[model samples]
Target: MEPVRLIMSGAVVGQELAAEFGPLPPSLLPVGTQRLYELQLAALGGTRQHLVLPETFELSAFDRERLVELNVEIAPIPEGLRLGEAVVYALNSIGAGDTPVHILHGDTLIAEPPLSEADVIVGGRRSNEYAWAEIDTDGEGRITALVDTRAGEEGREHQPVAAGYFAFGSAVDLLRSMTRMRGDFVAGVNHYLAGHSVKLARGGRWLDFGHLQTFFQSRLAVTTARAFNTVRIDGLTARKSSQDEAKIWAEAHWLQEAPPAVQVYCGRLLGFGAEDGKSFYETEYEYLPVLSELFVYGALGRQPWLRILASCEDFLRTCAGITGSGSGDAALKALAADKTLARLERFARETGFPIDAPLSFEGRACPSLVSIAERLVAAYDLQSGAPESVFHGDLCFSNILYDSRVRRIKAIDPRGLVGERPTIYGDLRYDLAKLAHSVVGRYDQIIAGRCRAERHGEDFSLAFEPIACQPWLEAALGDLSVRGVGGLSPAVRAVTVSLFLSMIPLHADKPERQKAFVANALKLFLQMERQ
Candidate 1:
């Protein structure tokens, strides 16, 4: 079967959504980590697609870059034309004459795509709430014609309407029909049907993102409505952008220059540049869930969690194998000692955290935050005399995604710095500590705002949503500990405490979150002191 190119009619102006979420097209509304258009591309599954735009619909730099990253070609047409005219004009302007093309509405996602066996397929569903093309069928149950509901009702009510997907045997017929209908989308379809037999495909999961409620609901169901990180994925490309240029550039560099052994575990960098003054980089995106979600979603009763841990262990071991032992103090000083101290000071200044006072929390006597951090830094210095391999500065469940179909985990958001330099080599123990910080320190829970901190000056109490998979997670961390991984390793354990304390400054917008980070750090520090 010859392949057909997809033409996404996405230039439809989203007046309501624009007023709510700014000037993003309705198609760009993010569901999960990817935009709605990315979901359409995934369902359609094509090498390339076209985004036909109204001439007045200007794209933001991020949107423009994302379209390019997804291999989607853009075609803008004159404004105020009917849908049929706009589509045909876009095709003609892009020089796609007479080619087999599948036209899908920007706001629609058809789970079951068009059947290529039929020369013409009109996807319809039994719904008339929204303005759509009314499907008219013959007595023999074949599609005979379509009427534009928005133009005039014409007494068509409660009939199967277009779900916004159309397939044609040839684009030439569409152009000729549109020419005859004078730019009426439904009329043009009916004109084309004078000779062509139309196949009616009904009853698949069709998602319409045009409505505000449905759009927000769908976006919430897949993932949080708000992004916890700067990474955006379209299942084809993942872009990590930040105002911090050096950090983003180093990440791209690490992925590109990664040793061949672990390169397979990294997102393949596609392109990178500064867009509108923000540094950004793109990599191939996948639809896999982050390990944090699966760890909590536990539908399979620990089997999936066990496999995820195994995959994570394999990844960490591979990273640890990248280099032999160096003196290790330089990386320790840069990544751990200096960074943790600096971050702790900032956390104190920003949050007025009692970092310089004696504290007793979670039933353990503790010194000031700065004192314990210094001691922990010394402890790491003594225990990490012979480092095993290079490090990924941030190695947590949120930064790692698992491909369950393949039983492998891929990593993203490498810290990309060993010490002062943005290089790929750092202390492997720090990486181990990071992975442990998520499990042993419960960092994901804190980030999700599930944790609470009750503080009375130097004393504090804390709690978070109980992890149902705590037993399994603890067992996995224990296994890593038994194998000399970081969870229970004295040096790595100290670094994990430092991680929790040092990261408090980053979540400045959420004072509650910062306090939780501080409490979690205190809890970990008390445990480390007992050891």
Candidate 2:
């Protein structure tokens, strides 16, 4: 079969969404590690796909290059054109002659689509959502008609809605029908169906992101995260851009500001600048498997996890050696002690958490939340001169990426702040605590919503999703707990437990996660007290 001439039209980003995410086409929104359009192109099984984008939506250089890498021909169209007219305009714009034309809406994705050699098949999703065209079918379940709900409501109850994937045998016939329909895209589709025996291909795996609620629903279903900045990535480069001057400026300057010996472990910085009033920077985006996802979800055996831990430890130790300092006694105390307590108190006030009362987790009685914070803060009295280092302030598992072929790991997204200022140096124990929270506290699992945390009176129950690699995780945790790499101090446990509590306010949107954070902190705190 000859390759289908594919054209995808992503719904133009609306004002509300553009205001928050900065004019990103819904197709380009990050889903997991890749963009929605990248996933669409991969699943739709098209060759040299053409993407129709609003001409005014100024294509970011990184996004244009990324789309070009996927062989997507950029067919820029004027804004305000009707969906049908726009699609037809895109088809007429392309030079392919008499080939099969496959049209897909960028916001829709189907897993394992039945891309059959049928003369006409239109994609439908099982949704009662009014945004989609209500599909009508004959006795044999062939698509007979469509009721576009955008005009008026019809019998759209739990029916297959035209969620926008179509494969027509002949582009010439499609153009003839669509051209006459003009701005009425649904009418054009119906006109074509009237002449052809159209098949309804409801792949059951249909995902839609056409509206505000559905967009986030589908996005969360695919993956998650980040608020201060927006990150765009191609195969070779990542650009983290934000209007927040302090955050972007610090991150963009990190490569140069970092200690020379520690700089080698990070992704190479390409450049940094302000564009359209937003601060932005670029870095080499060498795709590596994220360490957190691999440890928990990859189902790897003991040796693989061990090697990962070893490589990570080596990397951290090398940086620690290059970064150790005896300074910043006051700032370290203020950031870890005062800032943490402030955040924890804010969490209590926000969630009505009974911080003053003693709490228990898994039946183990523990100190009041405030008392725990005080103890942890007391432990971090840097006046005694614990060694500080130029550190990745937020060195959680998610930020560390590993390439198995080369047995190397590279880190990204340094916290880049200490106390009230932006800097590279902090207590090295804090960095270890960051890594420890991943191994022992299972911080990633909580963020992924794979853990359970339920409250009953003053007691709580918390359990991470069961994993086959739990034993290996336990083993690794024990090894790290006893004698941390680079002559670590026992203060890591205090800092790690405190971290779970202090971070609760940051994820205020996830109430269950906030509860989980409290529960995890109590669990880790009780364990530390017993030890």
Specify the highest-TM-score model's number.
2
- Give a tens-digit lDDT track for model 2, residues 1-531: 554545455455665444323345667654555567777887765565787787776664546767888888888777778887777777777765667777777777766666665554555555443556777888997788887665335444567677667877777777878888875878887888878888877564677765555654565445433886777765457888888888877876677688766776777889999898899889987645566765444445666667777776766776666544446455457556777778878988887877889988888788888899988866654665546667777778889877665666778888776755777776667777788888888887787666779999989999776656665765665565312332224467788888887888998888898899999999988877776
Q: What is the overall TM-score of model 1 with all chains considered together?
A: 0.60
Q: On residues 1-531, what C-alpha lDDT tens digit does candidate 1 reach at each position? A: 344555455455366554333344556554543557777777776664787766676665545766787878877778667777787787787777666767887877777776454455555554424566777888766789876666234335457777778887777888899889898878888888887887777635777777654554344334542344376656467677878888788888888778877877777789999887789899886555566543432223466667778887787777777774465556766777788888887877776766888887866678888888888877786444566365667888778877766888888878886654677777767777888888888887676555668888677788765656766777677667423545567887888888887777887888888778778888888887777
lDDT of each: 0.70, 0.71
Candidates' TM-scores? 0.60, 0.60
The residue-level lDDT of candidate 1 at 247 comes to 79
Instruction: Find the 10 residues in a row with the least total lDDT in model 1.
Output: 292-301
Position 141, candidate 2: lDDT = 77
RMSD of 1: 16.8
Give candidate 2's error at residue 227 in angstroms. 2.3
Clashes of 2: 0
TM-score, model 2 to reference = 0.60
